[model samples]
Target chain A: MKGPRLTEIVAGLPAIVPFVGPETQERQRGRPFRARLGANENVFGPSPAAVEAMARAARDAWMYGDPECHDLRAAIASQHGVAPENVLVGEGIDGILGLAVRLVVAPGDPVVTSLGGYPTLNYHVAGHGGRLVQVPYRDDHEDPEALVAAAWEHGARLVYLANPDNPMGTWHDAATIGRMIAELPEDVLFLLDEAYVEFAPAGAVPAIDISDPRVLRLRTFSKAHGMAGARIGYALGAADVIAAFDRIRNHFGVSRIAQAGALAALGDRASLDRVVKEVAAARDAIARIARQNGLTPVPSATNFVAIDCGGDGDFARRVLAELIARDIFVRMPSVAPLDRCIRISCGRAEDLELLARALPDALAAARA
Target chain B: MKGPRLTEIVAGLPAIVPFVGPETQERQRGRPFRARLGANENVFGPSPAAVEAMARAARDAWMYGDPECHDLRAAIASQHGVAPENVLVGEGIDGILGLAVRLVVAPGDPVVTSLGGYPTLNYHVAGHGGRLVQVPYRDDHEDPEALVAAAWEHGARLVYLANPDNPMGTWHDAATIGRMIAELPEDVLFLLDEAYVEFAPAGAVPAIDISDPRVLRLRTFSKAHGMAGARIGYALGAADVIAAFDRIRNHFGVSRIAQAGALAALGDRASLDRVVKEVAAARDAIARIARQNGLTPVPSATNFVAIDCGGDGDFARRVLAELIARDIFVRMPSVAPLDRCIRISCGRAEDLELLARALPDALAAARA
Candidate 1:
């Protein structure tokens, strides 16, 4: 018997989740991980004020949240030094990426990104039937020059680049990024994912004209603000491009609790400063631990550090497997050069202690 | 020089929001509504257990929610006596609706629904470039027979029918709905949006096999569970249809706090029973209040009652405006015969008392 048919685009797509969450791993192993340092989640947690705000909002969860995300957008706009019309708040960076892709890419349209860059963005692109042209990273960092060249080659309408790039925690300074922005093809839309920018050094995020319609800046509270579970993120772009999201976004997608929590967290500069300093210490400790284990740790501009496993991708894979078996959750990149290193998130001392204890044994086991 | 181009379809569709929320109205008026009986929200609020669970989850908002939605989906499966694979949870009914449409609708594909049924349903169809074929309601209820016939005529891939219908608060019995289902063409997928099913009568929902690929059922915690702001909803469909959602859905779209709140809300059956009973009482009270004000209250199975304003659609519109001016936030349908009535949601005594006190004045102002 015939049933309703799936659109050819969706039918052609494979059902896959870009990231395998740590919880799924725990379920398979029948136990919790000893150190939850994967997924770049902040271990220190959101501010007490943010938590309190969420609790307060929980009592009033009967009414639907403001579809316009009024107060939250106003606050975000003020912080960004742009008009509220220039901002678009959504479920998270993931949701905003999906909408951005939907707005610009049609079937058979070309889209470009680094080969092993954020898989979620690639997923959104592929889900929309966009042809993906993946350029390999240069010098272990997402190469802006290569991305621009690929976009021009493919006549790509979209290109995704993350500042303080994931998996390898590398970054380009503001002046370097400014030159990249200036060099971008006028017809291409740059999807600038700055999800980890808060942890990067000052000026890693180049100042770009918000009125310029070519680039969309994506930022999330999930990283430095320590509220990943809340799924709060926003996009800053030209007012018209921002307005385009209104045409297709699930307007009430953000939970009221998330809105209130993000708003509160944004106001708590002290908490942000504390988390940044704590993350820095944790990063340094992680580097020292890597050196003690005879692995070279890559200098990081984000909350996570990538450690060169002193071997190939396969060897790094084995090391990751050993870590997982020992209940120390860590992840590595999905592609060649980047995959030669295993990435670990900055964690509290207790969590790092677990990681430290497990690493030597994990390394021995992987070698065997 | 051109800067980023929008795809033809997105560029072509009108940028519009399906509903103007009451918050927007409040902002425009520069004052809050004294009585918020609009939007069909359960003003009594979520259970204490749910609020507590959400508050607890707030502390752990640093980690992302499980992409699989494991425990929450299992809990929902247990409640429905279906396998977890049969259920797909999303941001809300609106979110689920959008995904469902995206899966089945290609550009210019035909979809059938009642005229002025659910604007959001139409919005999703339009967003996905689906051609909407609207059949007029049969005697103020969603005309399933007409919808099916239209689907067959249009060779529609999808049909949306909201049982315990919105705007009119009317529904067909199980036997009638079963006939509607039986008559559906094999190629047409029936989208049964049972958002208000909890408030519907015992036999209002027809028995349909869970294995049936011909239909998918949507439900929400927004109404009976009083968690609209939490944004929790689910769809039960054939395994394949449910599985298809995985290919394109935002895996981590639902927030962890929402997941916790929904799980706790589902376990609190006492709260559900209490709310159902309270809603029924409120419906009766609304009818009595309508009679007291010399208006006709339509028989309701849903949480809200539709009051016939004793004149035309324009009269009803004027009365609704007057109620708004008096700070009584109530809504009326947007289309012809349906617009001849104003809808009032279930509210606590204080809220309804505000409505009760304001109705006569609103009506008098309308007449004057």
Candidate 2:
């Protein structure tokens, strides 16, 4: 018997994840990875205060969390120097992206982004039937000027850009991004994803004008605060744009413990500072390992480093596979040129040591 | 300035929540709720093992949750004697409902349900631009025959039914629902939301056929498992129907801590049995309190009792307001006949005592 039909937009899409999760890989291998250097998760973990907060809040899991997310939003608003109405919090940045895309994009509308940018954003665009107009990265970086030009050419409603972008770990300073934002088309909403901004220099985040309806900036506790599994993120935009999320978001999406943990994590300044220092050290260690193995490490402004394999995308893919086979989890971009390098997240000493020892064997195997 | 244009359907809708949460009420009142007996949350709490599980998982908040939900799905399927492919877990039943509605009902598509059955389902339908063909309830119970007839008349693609219904706390025997499913329109899909069935009597949940694409059954860890704040739920359907969710769902929506807590809760059958017994006792106590206050308590199959005020809708609404004014959280249905009753959730002895002490004054004040 035939069941209910899917909407044309969703039906046309394939079931795919932006990145294959480490857990899925573990299942396939029938063993857990020794180092989870893929997915770019912070290995340093959340603030101890946050962990204690979640533990303390665990027993009250029977009651539904405040659907409004009032207190956390208030704290976030204060931190960003924006009113609470200018922000909307959701399950994660991924979830917030879905709402952002849905609010502005109609089926078949044009969206602009860099080729081989964050795949999750593209996934959201596809799910909403938004046609993505992709431009190639310039000099291993997302060229804001090229992106703005493409949006104008396509008459796109939305354009996505990540400061201190994923996979490549490259960034543009605040002044350059400000210039880019100024030149962007009036009708296009700039979806500024600052997921890795915490790892960048102080000038990397452009000054945000909350009243500018064309710019929507989203930040998360996931990257810098090291609470990816907690899945808490918020967006800052014009009040009208932010309020649009209420029309479709999961009202009770954020878990109660998550709220408590995030709130506590925000308050723990020492932990944030400590994590940043540790992440810098890990990045340096990964670079050293790359240099010792006769590879070039790309300069990075984020928690992960990209090491050039001195070969093509296919060669890099083999290296990634060999690394996985050696119980060292790593990833590479799906596009050409960029895929000549493998990406590795910052990890603790033990995890980094495992990667350091396994790299030579993985490289040799890949060459063979 | 008009920035990016909203998709036409989303632009036409108003921002709304299915129900105003208790926290929102507290925010308006400028105080904490004294007795949180409004939302039908299990006041007895989840198993200690579940709490411990969440606490332990809190330390590992750096890692993203398993996107496939492999282990949790395996557990749920094992419990129900279904294959893992037949089950799909999500943030909650509310989230799962949104996915279900999006999968089937396109813009302007007709959906069949009871007029005031579940506002959230209607909200989902509206969010997706689906029209609702709401059939009125028959004597405080969902009229399955009427719902099926409406679907057939409208040639609707989706039909929703909440077994051991909420707000009204009523149920239909398995055989009757089975008959209703048999008579449902050939191409129509039935969404069976058995959220409150754990508090229901034997034979209340109909036998589900996993191979039947026409019916998809959703259950939650919120009610019987007492983990609403955890935001965990699962849907059961034909493998293909279940797989359809992979196309659009937030891959890492569920938190790692939440997954651990739910898995532990599912394993604690003794705790579930205890909660069921306690809930029954609380229901009886609420009924007794209603009778003592010169109100008629409707017989209930779930964890709440609806008390008729022996007056019209406005009278019951006032009674609800007076309780809220006293910092006692109780909710009443919004529709006509249903609004003639004030619904109280099964709370602990202390919460119930607060309700008992406040009812007479609320009644008197509402009458005045």
| Candidate 1 residue pairs in clash (backbone atoms < 3 Å) | none
CAPRI tier for the interface of model 1: medium
Real contacts retained, model 1: 0.85
lDDT of 2 by residue, A1-368 (tens): 78767889878999644556899999999999999999899989999999999898888988998888888889888988999999888898999998888888888899999998998899889988899899899888999999988988899999999999877999999998999888888877889999888888898988878888999998998998989998898889998888778888888888998999998998998999999999999999999999999999988889999999999999999999999999998988889889999999999999999999999999999999
Give the poorly placed runs of model 1, Cα more than 4 Å off: none
How close is every model to the real structure, measured as TM-score? 0.99, 0.99
Q: Which model scores highest in DockQ? A: 1
What tens digits encode model 1's per-residue C-alpha lDDT throughout A127-211? 8999999999988899989888888888998989999898799999998778888888897789999999999998798885897
Model 1: per-residue lDDT, tens digit, B69-104? Answer: 889989989888899999999999999999999998
Q: Each candidate's iRMS in angstroms?
A: 1.4, 1.5
Q: Pick the lDDT winner.
A: 1
Clashes of 1: 0
Q: Where is model 2 chain B poorest over a 10-residue stretch in terms of lDDT?
A: B12-21
